[model samples]
Target: MPRYGFIAIDDRGREYRAVDEAMSEAALEGRLRKAGHWVAKAWEIRPMLQKGGLFGGSIRVPTRPLTEFFLQLSMQLKAGIPVLTALSGEAGESPHPGLKRVVQDLSERVQSGQTLSEAMAAHPKAFPRVVVNLTKAGEASGNLAETCNRIRLYMEWQERIMADMRQALTYPAFVLVCALAFVFIVFTLLIPRFAKLLAELNVPLPLLTQIMMRTSDFFVHNWAGVLGGVAATWAGLHFGTRLSPGFALLVDRAKLKIPVIGGLWCMIGMARFAQNLGVMYGAGIALPEALGMVAGLTGNRVLEKSITELRQAVTEGRQMHSVMGSHPIFSKLVSQMIAVGETTGSLATALENVSDYYNEVLPRQIKRMFSLLEPLMIVGLVGFVGMVALSIFLPIVSLLNIR
Candidate 1:
């Protein structure tokens, strides 16, 4: 019996997390559901294989295909198509091969008389627990079509935020990489040529020229060592976080403490947190359970831990705004809005407002971030080129004066 860790909400909306022995993951979920627990997450306490980051993760259908699948499924079901008919059509019509295969399997399972959610549960990688959880809520509410539509909309919004982040960072990352390559070129090739020319001139070098020439010589002689050291350090940092939760948590904290970018990261995490929690809560999930689902979605372990504790606190009947207010990581805007939402008993709408507010803030911050980064990178590149040219020129001028 493998021990599984699970977070679930009882019918009374109380959250619980415990370790229980189960024969399989599905058995744990089934047992909890049988006991009237709405499970947010469940997994073997220690997986035989560790998977983290995109490459190590299980094969997942891309968001575009999944989004389209949900949209089509929602429409067909609303038009009164049978689950079997809808899934069968989707299996054939899905543009992505990976999703098509998953849909085909889903169709077969639906044909075998399992409910759509139950069938989807069997392929957790293809249909995430969130998707299955939302579908189950849909089934329970007898509004499967509406729930699926909402899921599609949420996915679209989340994907757009991610695409925007990538678009903003992509050019900066490219420029940084190019600048580093140019620096390497100067140290190994261009600077060395100047160094040799100066040496043949046999003139006294300025202090700056002396320093740059020595740096070039060291790099030329130890290029292998320099590259190896960088590669080794990077690999160590990358794998260390994956291997140790404590270190990863520290790193997550450090990420939020970094300058201009740190504030941006916090806003993004908060927006995601509010949006996910809102969507789940709006779909009829309890707050504790919705928080359980959202804990991992914030993209920051520190925030994840805070939300996890918040889930526990809410489960214990504490006010969510009170808990959020105490955490410095949470913005006043979020805490204040949450307090208003709680007072008015429209917490879900409040959450959506929080998310909306951040969505608007994100684009402005991203543009500001770009404005800072672009000028800094340009200055850095120009500085490097100027230093190299000055270092080379100073020595030549001295050599001519001596002659």
Candidate 2:
């Protein structure tokens, strides 16, 4: 599908610019007319950039328990029930208001002669790429219910991994906030009082004390400028990435170079890619198409490039295991498993197993990270606060001796 950027006039003669996907210019015009807009100008969008907001932008959706939905859909379909009827029933009984609305809209579109995959694609935020691709593949292969079950299992595993990651991150975030607050209090309240006492005593200060005083003076004098600079830098990076793909790719590359967290990020992306690829392949999709979809879903430009290479290698008849082994980000164990799967003609199952392996290991890794982080945070807090406290108290003791 090609994306067209159009300038159109509504019934009230108000002009609006919108970008939409269509098969051709005629279809694009027809869509605009159906939406009650008169096309004035239209141009094709040559390239689409990968972008997301802090809160995931339009992609962020409310929490939904997809497990029950999938299980019900699978059971109903497997029982020879119609897709439209199943969706309509689920739409009515859905516990999540957001998901219910989505199902209602999907049911309506699907009932109105649209394919199930097409209906799902319209709700990009609600249905991720893996779900939509699997739906498309399932529809093609006449095994939609089975595909849904597989997707549900994968989603459940993903949800658990995400929960573990959040748990790991939360403690460090709390400690960081506490440390910042402590520093602020010391500089704003304690340091000023100490400076006054030292001034009254008319005594020469120690080098360490002088250095601390200068640091406080600089912060106090330029706090607004420092904060503004930070805000501007953040805004610049955010907006710059939106304007240029090259910058986004650069940042993605840099992100992979970061230690500990970077390794975790790489693994998570690879796991997600393998899982989605397995879903697609298991649903009878071609390897090329599965690799393409996996690339889009990875959300890392560097990783995407690697997957693209893998796709090209598959297109060229290169072995999947060999291609995977060439990438440093992929583990040797995973590559070996791929080799075995390829030789045994069970690549999909192998990929699924690889994903399962990561899914099982990730939580333990997160737990270990949190275990280390908790004590590290406590030690950091104590050390920093103790140092500041000592700096404050030592000056007071010296001033009292003069008294």
**lDDT on C-alpha atoms for all candidate structures:** 0.84, 0.79
Candidate 2 local lDDT, residue 229: 97
Q: Residue 269 of candidate 1: its Cα lDDT?
A: 89
Position 236, candidate 2: lDDT: 85
- Report how far residue 235 has shifted in candidate 2, in Å: 2.0
Writing each residue's lDDT as its tens digit, candidate 1 over 1-403 gives 5666567789899986666778998988888889899878765533321123234533478888889999999999999998889998888888898787678766655554468887677666767788888899888899999989989988988798888878888888998999999989988888888878777867888999989989988998998999899999989879988999898899999999999889888888888898888778888888999999999989999999999999999999999999998899998889999999999999989988987888788877887897789889989999988998898888878877887
Best by lDDT: 1
Clashing pairs in 2: none
TM-score list, all predictions = 0.83, 0.81
The best candidate by TM-score is 1
RMSD of each: 9.6, 9.0
> What C-alpha root-mean-square deviation, in Å, does candidate 2 show against the real structure?
9.0
Cα shift from native, residue 18, model 2 (Å): 25
